[model samples]
Target: MSHTPAPSRYDRQPYRRSGRSGLLLPTLSLGLWHNFGDVDRHDTAREMLLGAFDRGITHFDLANNYGPPPGSAEVTMGRVLREDLAAYRDELIISTKAGYRMNPGPYGEWGSRKYLLASLDASLKRLGLPYVDIFYSHRPDPDTPLEETMGALDQAVRSGRALYVGLSNYSAAQTREASAILRRLGTPCVIHQPRYSMLDRHVEGGLLDVLAEEGIGCIAFSPLAQGLLTEKYLASIPADSRAAKGGFLKPTDITPGRLAALRGLKELADARGQTLAQLALSWVLRQPVMTSILVGASRLAQIDDALGIIAAAPLNDAELAAIDAALALENATT
Candidate 1:
């Protein structure tokens, strides 16, 4: 490994402290939920990751089952880590989750002490690192006792496998339950990664409130709503869009009414001299606890475009009202 980093391969983006925590994550963090896997272009992944780092995106998020074949994304990240960012490991915040399926067996998935602890160790080995900046429980497992699940995360921190622990896709109430356990165990329950976008106001159902009340940080994932909130879907699902993909996004989900709302949102974006993707990201990031907006990029340009959103001004009263009207239309049919 080189003694120094590769001549600053990334630009520095704005940084915000995740809640009141000492950690300052980049305003826009990268997630390996899709397209960083086995079949996706390796150069694209490398360039995007490098571009993000050059732009000061220090935090990178991943899960055990992120790759198309499962675990390939982490392997690829590991390769990148060794090849490019090895010297700068101390400055990066790399995180991985384990609640989702990684194997077929009954104990292969879910939030158990056994599964999370084992999964983190596997992730660490694949990343070629002694420890991760943060480790998250991918989801709430109703079958497993929250205590046991929470204990798993607590163990990760105490065992020196992960510096801090986080929760993902967990509801406000469930977050409290798990958070309570982790806090009692003396583990730093630092953040939560949740899906939040204009099309998905599910967080308003109390998740954000709980995070706020607890002083825990939150990174809103899929801030583009899987690209549906972007201008790319205004006309029709482009063959290259997520909608065009056979899974995750369905054609039926993009109804005429939804398209109209999208159009209105796009129009709003155009009026502001910004793209819909930027607008959607700025909207959700307006919240205080909105520590970082987790984004996925298939190209360096897309990542740059998202980074430009940091310059976006806060939405005013009129913009908020207009957005509410658009959401009303969506509620009627959604």
Candidate 2:
């Protein structure tokens, strides 16, 4: 008789190819952008991560400066990976960045070779991994030459510290230059992580084109506009919302006009029998160039909601037209 292994809980979420790469990423990726910091409960962070993976979130986004105390998120993730997720590391796509300030000296941050190499080492130590699947430059450094940063990223790949190299928060033109440098260094940039949402469509300005021309994947962050795209603020900011916590989401960003527009969006989402957060996420992953939507969840249930959005399917022309109209008004006023 043939033996059948028990089904893993992660058999649900759908996966899509990340750009033109050989790897396939889940449509929804969990990000440790906020609340997974030093101040948050370790158990809660682990639960959120475990719940996400169980629901098929194979990709996890983090940066060296992710914590309030800096590097705490990675340290926390390291514990979870060791305690519960170690055996499944091959199934995980872990990414970390290093362009931000991590130390006091000039060489301690930015795109210089010294900072990049050293920062990747520190991140690896905190992550407790031999190599991360993807290593990002975090952001563009104006003062530092692009070659230096790209070169360090190449070294990270060549030395087997990171398997793939990516750039984050870089402009369309900047990405063009960075790609050239990476190509010369023999490390082709695989992806570009950018902040994109219904409200923040700046990447649509031109960056998506660069990503396509270079065959790089686009992983969108803040697809829900830092919770502004969710029904959580349909009435008013709740006590536990990011705005209330004075974190990444700001109070001023939630103007009366924006709220009214969101009410319309909330109604639209209700008509589809889904939450505004789900719809907002659905909108981002709709694009062909989009590899994944990087989202943050404070609770396991929130992760459940995110995973539910992956199989929502394509939006019809009518829905797209309505979204375009509503978002046009919002953008005009912004």
Candidate 3:
């Protein structure tokens, strides 16, 4: 079946400028890190993509090694584009990264020019696009010089493989240096992708400050903290939950103290007439440096719940204080 995007898609959602760049990204971006893979149903993936676009999510983030087998998410996205979104190609912000391992070998991973450029080509082929809107160096490679990595990003744009370049999982110092190199090369780092949430506040110590000072956009991945911030693990881990599946998140990660914090946060969310996920997302976006939040959905309803935060009110000072208080308990136990 052919899919048609709704005409009223862009009416409600607002787009934020990516740092000092000319590119504008929807406040909510969809990530194809989990469900859009060969192991998942194609029709359901297609529905999630279409549903996201219908709700005004124009940015779709992917990585070279997202799938369990690797690169399958991009193939799934390619099919969705060919089947449904080809006509609206110019209206979307498609992004992919290459710094993680895509194949087994020395040249398979890292920020080396060889790996970054070759990975971009592979990603483009899988995505069925001539160029990605934003190409990211998925993580900083300590083994490679910063100049070499930044130069690869610069060359990616210069060669017309990517329009803009970004850095992911880089520390504040690394981002500052990378941004300087990209700036000197005349392709300023447009954004930074980091794992940030109430549970993970490493970025707040200095990375957020660096982004603010350098005028770089910040898009948080894992804003839901691997479903720990959601209602899924309130009582017991669902059989289908990520924690139960045991990869990135484990059953042991959720202790009684963390659950207590979640319960407290959930009550606050309920008082505010929003879900815990919504509250967590809103908290991440409260920072001005946050250009958007990347969320992964197993179902269309999850996407809907995430997009619903766009219309919800921002968290005020009192609410923030309450959240910090609840988090303080989790921290104390840790």
| Residue 186 lDDT in candidate 3 | 97
Task: Tell me each candidate's TM-score.
Answer: 0.95, 0.95, 0.98
lDDT of 2: 0.86
Q: Rate the local accuracy (lDDT) of all candidates.
A: 0.85, 0.86, 0.93
Candidate 2 has its poorest 10 consecutive residues by lDDT at 1-10
RMSD of each: 2.0, 3.1, 1.0
lDDT of 1 at 36: 89
Per lDDT, the best of the predicted structures is 3
User: Lowest summed lDDT over 10 consecutive residues: which window, candidate 1?
Assistant: 1-10
**What digit string (tens of lDDT, one per residue) describes model 3 on residues 58-119?**
99999999876699999999988987889899989999999988888899999899999999
lDDT at position 253, candidate 1: 79
Deviation in Å, model 3, residue 86 alpha carbon: 0.8
- lDDT digits (tens) for residues 263-305 of candidate 1: 7887788888889899898898898898898999888898889
| Candidate 1: segments with Cα more than 4 A from true spot | 1-11, 331-334
